[model samples]
Target: MKKSISITLCAALLALSGCSQNTSSDALSSDISSAASESQSTASQEESSGSSLQNGNGGFKVEGTKLLDANGKEFIMRGINHAHTWYLDEDTTAIKAIAETGSNVVRVVCSDGEQWTKDTENMLETVINLCIDNEMIAVVEVHDATGKDDKTALDKATDYWIEMKNALIGKEQYVILNIANEWTGGWNGELWRDGYTESIPKLREAGIKNTILVDAAGWGQYAKSIGDYGKEVFDSDPDKNTMFAVHMYGTAGKNSSVIEKNLKYAIDNGLCVIVGEFGYTHTDGDVDEAFIMKYCQENGIGYIGWSWKGNSGGVEYLDIANSWDGSVLSADWGENLVNGENGIKQTSVKCSVFTKE
Candidate 1:
């Protein structure tokens, strides 16, 4: 989840220039724009696959806004987002250390050879095995698409999943595939809708069946998109095995009222949602992390704090642990997220998928 500040000069120029004269050239341009818009709408509809409850790998399925295990038990994701892609050296023990915090799930960041070193099939297998051994649900994500505008990177992420099909096919009980960390930088509901509706089914097509999780727009903070277009996205999934993620930061996670409103909106609207990434503080703005934890704990909504260790570039405070070995915890962010009231230790419940019961 990255946000690069940008200002489009053309938008400002258009505002200053006002409406252009409707000359013959302008009329022709208007016609072209209308046609392009219509064409895109039609293409989105065509590309969107119909809904199904196929249960390809027969592991977890979404049943009326709840994540159900193969045994039909509810699995709330009380977890943490581990930055494995950024901190490759910690790959060996991150899952176990996070599991020791009493978390039932772990969202691991990954790349598809696009931006960072590719997490090879062997690496993925290691990560998945580690989660299984530690009795945690592994939600692997592609980070290369973070804050991207085009679908090329998203498509590449899809292809990467297909390449690792052999490792993923039978692990549906323990794994969930997060399509992309934050696939688009802009808030184009149509683009986000069309992108997932078209690309997600490819996994089922390749026989890699796992519950899918898609992040919201605006670098995973624009939760309004979920309120606006969530139903359409849910209906687009062939398996109906999908969940939505919202990363609360300065924009959408600023206050207690705002946090409660966004969480209520998604749950009230009958869409399964999780707080994929959040922190007590950020350069973007202060996050009401206390309210976030309390709200999720009370509502039975899944929540995972920003990270375990290894954060930098002016946001080093996000690192929950002071060291890579997970010995020391940070003063504010780490302590609040993991051990404070309404924190993971107090609220986390292990998924039935792992327990023998």
Candidate 2:
């Protein structure tokens, strides 16, 4: 069994911003305990409101803060992000290799002809089928809007999803439509909320019903944006089938306290969230990857490490597997995330839908 941390020690480890040095440990503990209780109460209320798989349109659904697969079984995404748009040729074999690590999901990056070559409808179908063949869920995301605060880019991405309806309309049971990766560049919570609130309906109106995943603003590190307006954005979805995601790099993953506080706030708000992307370390600073994996595991949250391979721009170290076929894994990030305690290999369970007769 995975080791657990006490609430008190967990609170104590929080940064000074969270727990003042002048504050007594007892007071800190009391505050954290209250928050935890409130979170549980809120989750219970959400579940009681009929937010279960029965309400879903035959696809993934969010119940309270848990994700239920098409089979109505709880599913936690333990997987890696594969940059398919950049390394299209490697995906065929790379996805199979990723499945070998016991992962149950793969966040496949694609472009909408805005920033990179548009992944044609045929290519999209091929990639999603590859993941399904490997017994993993496909999280299809458009990379064109990364770090763009402009609403036009986000709209274009939405348009791309609509154009690919032929490939996504019937794959709701096996695919997640991540609207656009890091759609906003700044930490403007209001803008972030408005952009998604506007774009989500467009996708729904276009006949897309897959569970939508929206990344946090500020290049996906601004968890504060999600904590502040995640509910409003989620409510914008007419289907109420949207979930939030946060990319944890140095800015958001520098310490245990920051990570806990960000993720806890989202969970406490009764929002379905996942660590959509995270690296062991980044140019901004070092990341507490160990805590991220441990906390997600114990809390029944989901995480997808960034990435499978083919990282560039001086961030090549972020690649988890060195060889495309996964014949050799990186010594630090790859080894630990895939094979270490609380890692994918130790915790992932294939979605029950694949096993059902």
Candidate 3:
């Protein structure tokens, strides 16, 4: 994904775009209990009107294509991606503002101590808490894995998560561990499978029970990666609680057929799949955002538009919102994503985890 020409002038065109590895088991257990307790006081009030009281596992589980809570109620993700790592200045109100847009989920970008500033354990706590406070499902991803062909970057991401296991100990229901964003190094299926198979056990062993989300290779645009080996990766998890994510842009999501095939291959096989990030137009190609939103809503698949703001390079047109506060939205990308016919506001259902009583 090379940068387009300096999009600085695109405005004229119309842009819119853990406790550590060594902590004792008992101590970890206690921390999990306390964190769960701390959030419940507020969580109970945030539940969806039809959602049941969430307790063990806080109600997030996968059944076919749907993400069901403890009550077996569906929680479809209709939300936007936030590049928090790249725009730290917006951290103060990103979550709050994202929630205000009627998003039931927020994919927060973070560095895994490799390509960008390391997100420490404390920072993870604050970020996750912010998501909960705003009643949105937090999908945390390590951005360092982008275009990485070498498994080293993937391993490093795993290690980073293990180190921050403390913050994730008991937040299974409120957060999803997106192992790495587009770990698309060479499109090697072996690396993707072996990487997750090896790392997932480490997380489950560490008591990080959050539903693990593994991105498809090929810069996350290759949906076949999941269709080809999604089951193995899903079963590899000791908890059998893993989901596959696909990032669609011009290459893979240019039309309705491509979109349906990619998503259906995974869902047809009885696995949970989600479109991790996508845009109406990209430096790579023109994305069929309309088909994406329409199909996902009709089929029960979760979808998050590729970002609120801070899009640089030549792809400034990808930004869904005009500013950090999200007060202004772009004509095509931003407006279509949040307010269009099949947009988030029209299709998203708040997760029972955040609103169930």
> Could you say which candidate leads in lDDT?
2
Best-fitting candidate, scored by TM-score: 2
Better by TM-score, candidate 3 or 2: 2
Alpha-carbon runs more than 4 Å astray in model 3: 1-56
- How far out, in Å, is residue 202 in model 3? 1.3
In the range 51-95, model 2's lDDT, one tens digit per residue, is 334536678887668888776678899999888888889989899
lDDT of each: 0.77, 0.82, 0.76
Ranking by lDDT: 2, 1, 3
* Comparison by TM-score, 1 against 2, better one: 2
Among all windows of ten consecutive residues in candidate 2, which has the lowest summed lDDT? 1-10
For candidate 1, lDDT tens digit of each residue in 162-262?
A: 99877787788889999888787677778888888888777778777788899987677767778888878887777777889888776567788888777
Off by over 4 Å in 2: 1-55
Clashes of 1: 0
